[model samples]
Target: ERRFSVDLVGEVVRNFTLTLWNTYAFLVSYANLDGWQPAAGGSPAAPAALTDLDRWILSELHTLVGSVTAAFEGYDVTGATRPIERFVYDLSNWYVRRSRRRFWKSGAGPDKQAAYATLHECLLTLSKLLAPSMPFVADAIYRNLAGAQQPESVHLADWPAAEAARIDPALNHDMQIVQRLVSLGHSARQRSKLKVRQPLPEAAFWAGADAAGVIARHGALIADELNVKQVRLLNSDLEAVAYELHALPRELGQKYGSRLPAVRDALAALDAATAARTLLAGQPLALQVDGMALELLPTEVEVRLQARSGFAVAAEGGLVAALVTDLTPELVREGLAREVVRRVQELRKSSGFQISDRIRVRFQASAQIAQAIAEHHDYIAGETLAVALQAGAVSADAWLIDAESLAVQIELAG
Candidate 1:
């Protein structure tokens, strides 16, 4: 019953993501099959045994779907729209980017395959949920993944039956804490104006018991996303979280004269959380400095944080850092492989390589990269469409440059 033009819808489509919208339509590549889907279909199916992580994701999805659908029924398309988009854009993008390879090479392995297949199924389920809001984007993803293989269009797929039985509440809460922990790091980067691509040596946080498990399970995810080498959990109480308080010693000293310490102490005595919120909200405070009435505005001071134990601690903007642990050689190499694929994909995008275009690539690089390529040779070949790669040879028809700290070239081979 809602009315808008194709142009308007097209414009809205541009604002949404393909994977996000695909979650709206149901099954991929299928047309007009809305009541049932490839996995659970419309009625209901018992979930195949899934990973705790996977089950947790499904639990989150179901939570969102019930709420989103209710919003839709109430004519709050915007409300329905936002959650699905966020889950796909945030959770799916973050997780899939971190775990794709385990699925890629699983072949017939049941557990790993289940891990991947569950995610894949989740993606489809989400696309159906989103299609009511964004048609074009949902259709494209649906067509690509399941369309040719099974379904005709994602839009026609039915909504999956809602089930809350499989969700892990503890995992969900822990994840939210971890998410907040990651956000604190990202906010720090924002304050520093640091681009995510730049790597950092380490980040340490007062990893409390509440967020510890979440951080442990996805510590690698945090490192990869934040470009930090190491994450640490420290039990310390004295590390200062930084922020501009309403009264810095020198600034307040000039105003308060002999009373500066008392004023500073009073301000410091306020909990970090309250001080930050008050500062952010532009709330005004009244104080007497040298027996003169003073009014304080929020922006006059700044804040930052360092880890502490039993300090009941936090950073300005309420950011709490999460620690990272464990890095394996295999993990590093796999990350490099993804970087190589990214370079290839970027070139393809720039040079107008068609979706199905076959290509050849040659790489010239240091021994380390050469070995990485040699080790993941099949993966590299499949990823880059490269017919051959050698340590010394250069491609005659290829784009050549550097990637993963290695010189490389790629082209359509004759």
Candidate 2:
């Protein structure tokens, strides 16, 4: 309990502080330069077009507003705190993390503008929602985000009203499915000893019929999050999975008191594979025992899934993910490119380069690393904001980064 408290407090402080500060920096750096404000008249127009991610976040925000408001009105402090905590988590980890590139891109296109507006709105709303729980931090956020044009204090501002029309249950459901698959993918990678930095060819998800379409719709998002080349929603992959069913003796015995042994024998004789598959497919398993017909419900049996060889599997609450462990030459090259980018970024930070500073990169490395850089030259250059990338000796002033059997040097371009 003590450790749990410490961890939760640390997570809240780290995530909330960094994310809020970053949001303030973004608004000051980008939106202010564009003369944008969160006030009613001065704010940028609502995005004419919203991505699926955008809509999902908006819906989640609406839900948060309703939940928090109801909790406060009912005098339930813990309930109110829970919603605020969850919203902060999703806003920082999911929304901000995924949409960072949009905010960082140089130009102020429609997409960038929409991203800025959406984040601004979210931050402002969060200020009001959090004011009652965290007065000082909430007030600071509200003032920085809204004080310039609106209320002088967050406490003086009216509570944000939830928008019912913006809520989309279908989109929220799909996003939840995507989140689950991404989590399972992380577990599979851990089990296989594969770092997320190393790219994989594919990850497979076995979704029920009701959720298969939803999972397929967000295949690209899942693939990117998992750092895999592709995502396959394998509705039929269950054939490769084996399942075992254990009859709950207590529950079965309660129903068949005198005939418990007979019922147990009938269950033991049932075709395990067929029964497993039938139950997994959400169909009832029927049995003809002692001249009586009976159908088995899920509660009467416990199911366990076993994966075949060559796959890393993780499952929870009826959802399963099977990640392919085989890595190809092309995938390895891409993985190396990613590693190079990571190293260069680290060098930039260590060398005290500004976030907006463009630089020239120079490297002398092994033949394999050289090939990877050459093949993915454009990607490396764009990601690091490099004006030039070349292969050769490192300059005396450049920062040197060494990896296993690979070395590279980078310097800020004048």
Candidate 3:
């Protein structure tokens, strides 16, 4: 009777680990054969981890154990695997990439401190979740985070206390929408044959599903990341066109059997939101055929809306489509402003400028560029390590310039 909801997670993890290690081990073994020296002897990292990045990884590893323990208590293996996937795929990939500069920062500064703190938290969490699955990697990360004052092995210590307050439903929802928008943006970039680094004029999103204030609150973030000057909310006519649905073949046919056609027709009669809520909430859709009622579960259903005509960005359920809008004068200025700061920073870094190093930039360009920088002088100063920016390009030998980039050369003129 106790086996009613048995925990197979430990075995599941073991099986998954074996599959993964088999793939990894083959590569490493073959590498050793090809390299003339054993691949296992390779030192891809330092002999001992001492950097902030190392500490960050350790902290995330430890924190992850607490999460896994909580997930196990709830008997939710799927929830448990989520953070594990994050550690491997997202925390490892995105966090590591974002913080590389801090890890490789030649000099210690505020930037370095921030990078360490962020990475440490991620590492500690990841290590804790991993402890039960791969004790060695878990212990290694845990011990490193512990350092002189903390316990040697996290396993020998007490189970971590839960921090339930840290979970915010609103933030999670916002992040999910943001992630979908980002995916759509990446798709748009690919379709345009443009790299993310290339500046985009504007992006428009059709958000018929967005709650009243959520889109407004996070609109700035969407605009910034997409390099668009503005985000336009499409009209209701566009929303209807974008939200048209199509039936999923296998999903409906298998679950409903003969009841599928009636259910599909009933769903088509309902609007996107009403149909989604009714089907998702475990409420019976009440499709009657031969006077017999049927029930539909969430997973047994799949509904996706089609792309609307002239829509720059739209999402029906999880599927997304985006459209490009005309870039505003304001957007072009912001893009230019970003470019100016980037070039300035490159100049500062290469010139061995201190974080507080104040410099002057005098660029002669169309009145458009001049007015743009002038309007956002404080931002320009903060971002570019500039004491003052004067709009006039003069011949100077010391300045490093790139005119082809529509950017005049810059330097520390004595």
List, residue by residue over 227-333, the lDDT tens digit for candidate 1: 78866665542343433355665655676678767776666666654565556445755555446666655544555444333222344332355333233565456
Score candidate 1 by TM-score against the native. 0.61
Distance (Å) between predicted and true CA of 41, model 2? 3.6
lDDT for every model? 0.59, 0.77, 0.55
TM-scores across all candidates?
Answer: 0.61, 0.81, 0.49
lDDT winner, 1 or 2: 2
Question: Residue 314's C-alpha lDDT in candidate 1?
Answer: 44
lDDT of 3: 0.55
Candidate 2 lDDT, tens digit per residue, 301-410? 77776777767777655667888778787777788888889988988999998777899988877776788888999989989989998887764443232353455677
Ranking of candidates on TM-score, top first: 2, 1, 3
User: What lDDT score is found at residue 39 in candidate 1?
Assistant: 40
Report the number of backbone clashes for model 3.
33
TM-score between candidate 3 and the true structure = 0.49
Cα lDDT of model 3 by residue, 1-414, tens digit: 444333566654565554334323332333233332211311122314334334334444545656787788899887777677655644543345545445443454545544444444444545666667678867876675544545668687455554544344455555556657766777766655554544566566545466325557667767766766566654542452334445565877876688778777776766765555454344545455546776555566664444444334434343344656445667566656666677677778887865545677766655665666777777777777566787665563333222223344455545
What lDDT would candidate 2 get against the real structure? 0.77
Using TM-score as the yardstick, the better of models 1 and 3 is 1
True-vs-predicted CA distance for residue 272, candidate 3, Å: 16
